[model samples]
Target: MVDRLEQSKALASDVRLTILTWLKTPALHFPHQVTGDPAEIGVCVTLLADTLRISQPTVSRHLEVLRRAGFLRVRRIGRWSFFARDEITLSDYAEWLRDTL
Candidate 1:
């Protein structure tokens, strides 16, 4: 289906994959975000940008696309935006990857 293809296309990019990898490592992948502590909940946008060595807007854009595809869950704290892995879908993705390989 077009939806699956589109989501696959989104994940096909190295940058997006890298983002997922980063999400797995709290200390190294993200900066200190006090609002939505990754240690407690998830990573925030500013932290995601700083760790990725990219602009906030750029990272935000990528995150938006990923979120739209049911790959992530976003939270807001004041002006700060936070994101986390959608465990259910992520587990499915992992399972699919395993089956495919």
Candidate 2:
């Protein structure tokens, strides 16, 4: 289970929110990847960095937070990392919001 406080903190930033929003519909937000499917395998870290106009390390930091919060899942292919949203967790969080708020 995800820590509610951590999940809330993960959603606190505008940049993080944008990242989640883009990831929610990667095909619409990101370019066609060469290796894996965006929806299935996830978006590449390099692609996310380029799209966000941020350093890879910076993007990694944000991704780490979301990962810890259980909002994202990562897949390693060679030396590259791909990220996708945890839809079940997202739905749970939404339901949590509806119940709690």
Root-mean-square deviation of every model: 2.4, 1.0
lDDT of each: 0.76, 0.92
The global Cα lDDT (0 to 1) of model 1 is 0.76
User: Where's the lowest-lDDT run of ten residues in candidate 2?
Assistant: 28-37
What is the TM-score of candidate 1?
0.80
Per-residue accuracy of model 2 over 3-93 as CA lDDT, tens digit each: 8998999999988999999999988887568886799889998999998999999999999999999999999999999999999999999
Considering every candidate listed, which one attains the maximal TM-score? 2
lDDT of candidate 1 over 2-71, digit per residue (tens): 2555567679777788887877776565556656458557788877788788999999999988887778
Deviation (Å) of 64 in candidate 2: 0.3
Q: In model 2, what is the error at residue 52, expressed in angstroms?
A: 0.6
